[model samples]
Target: MNTFTETTNTASTWGLYEQMRPQEIEAIQEKTPIAYLPWGAIEYHGNHNPTGLDSIKAFNLCKDLAEKNGGLVFPVVNLAANLIKSYPGVNFPKHSIEFSENLIRLVCEEYLEQLVAQGFKIVVLLSGHAGEPHLTILKTVAEEFNNKYPDKRFWALAEFDILPNDLLVANHSAIGETSLQLFYAPETVDLETLPKDRLITLELDAVSGDDPRLATIALGEQIVTSFVKNGSIIIEELKQKYL
Candidate 1:
């Protein structure tokens, strides 16, 4: 038996076993101890999106996933792996890829160790910020952790990976991520304040995508639906094959 729970009341659900009453915790412990970690970064998206976009995306997506798969959901990790970009006056030059990667690895290892100590064996590191270097570093660290532990597992996904490779393109605050955030946290988005021109790949280069002004709650719902549907398939496959 593992210590975990399946609940949709996000505001009331216990994020960690430590946060729950002893009885509740024991009940979950008798069930499943697996957990879902939402890894996100605090970085600039653009003039429109929130700096906590990555965290927000991860949190919401994890919530959806946790509801479907019974497990504890750790709070969003706001500071993820990223680099600093010095824009004259628009944004601060806060690149911290190396630093962030080290910190992310340390924090994740510490957290996973703590959970293991508490009798949990599974911890998933789902990264919402899809920076190539960030993802690379994250995967490397996660693999090393798994190799060292051997009895535990770490995993990640940004939802886009489920799509066919040729059908996808490198998009930052464009159709992919923006659509996800829009679908997950529409209230946080304010299209009325958006630039007349679309901002493309806010991370690497100054590129724009389709006018985000046209982004609607409906589109957001569709994205979430797709993610949940595909994520369910993936989870089931992994569980049957690995767990």
Candidate 2:
């Protein structure tokens, strides 16, 4: 169903990181030596969109990027995001279930270190959730890694960070993300779940930004194209700069 995702990195049994064998990883690394880590949360999206939208969107986008640019997509980081720090004590689920900023930093730091240990020359952290606090943490950790590992390259960003300003319409449970899924994984989106002829809002439907009803696969494709293009450039740059 996901035509774009189904392609690329699927060459002769070599697949994403999860399905790759030792020899496959070494072979791919010999060619690209790049690793991609996609992250998002299991938090609510809305009545129509699945809750895994964030992570799924990121993962699918990563697959597209790897297909175009050549790399291995690490497994999705589903438990990475946390509640907005501004709402300190107010959490949808128990605080224990949601890791804190410190824990998040540790996880990212460890992941980066392990990727490097696995012989990856370049590492990318891609997020779909775009939660302010989580993004901030990821960016900080990336900078630290870049400084500490002069021999390797590290980059961290949400899907929109590299996009041209005009295409930066990313948001939660809205047109931007929904359209992305429509293009990347249409089977996961259920627009009919929302009431007929009713306005969608953040409070009532967990929808934000312009109405998700406006999302289209064409628009999603445009966004995906931009992401892959810009991301490829970044990887090339890292190779030149660090490798």
Candidate 3:
């Protein structure tokens, strides 16, 4: 028997696309026609962290942002690219599922088209999967589509794109990312698997930042709070400028 475990408790369906009703969606659209689309992939993040970390983190952030900023979380095709194999930085042939750039572009465009059709005035595409080429494709697609639709606007960025470098440095599966999961999805992280004495380097296990032992739920909450604070501000700015 497969028993389901509930992760979050505060109005579980507050901004989720899957759990919302048509009328509720329309009501939100009547007020703020903003949509948050979280994207990520099934990539290996050492044995300690779940491969779904990127996707889960992005989804969790979207949920929080929607609650604070007011938006309907939209679902995207589960496809990701720019794995360790192609990326210039840390490369780990870990358990990862990759898709072609062409497919990623096509899928992204399809979702944007649907969101535009739904009459969302502002569309925010945040990718937890942060890589230069992959992120560029999303941003390019959004920008070109913006030109196509004068009335509607599309903004695309990685989770780390809008964050300050000092507060939350971007690493593959290092301290920052791991800490995020710890805060958002504690069950998925097992720091004990990683050694506490030695440094956890990219060469060792594709962990590109500080040691995992240093990560704490408090630290994760701090980073998450920063993301939410900054994210909410930027989203409010978008609403004021455009809406």
Which predicted model would earn the best lDDT? 3
Stretches of candidate 3 off by over 4 Å are 1-14, 85-91
**Lowest summed lDDT window (length 10), candidate 2:** 88-97
Q: Write the per-residue lDDT of candidate 3 for residues 1-243, one digit (tens) a residue.
A: 111122333432246777788998888778878899998888888878998888888887777777777778876446888876555665576588889988899999998999988889888898888865787899999999989987777989777776788767778788888888888788889888987777777766778677777787777777777777787778878888777
Candidate 2, residue 211: Cα displacement in angstroms equals 0.7
Instruction: Write model 1 residue lDDT over 20-40, tens digit each, in one string.
Output: 676776665555456777888
- RMSD of candidate 2 to the true fold? 3.3
Model 1 ranges off by over 4 Å: 1-19, 84-99, 164-170, 197-211, 241-243
Per-model clash counts, in order, read 15, 0, 0
For model 1, give the 10-residue run with minimal summed lDDT: 1-10
Cα-based TM-score, every candidate: 0.76, 0.88, 0.88
Per-prediction CA RMSD (Å):
5.8, 3.3, 4.4
- lDDT by residue for model 2 over 193-231, one digit each (tens)? 876677786666666687888888988888888888788
The model with the greater lDDT, 2 or 3, is 3
Backbone clashes in candidate 2 total 0
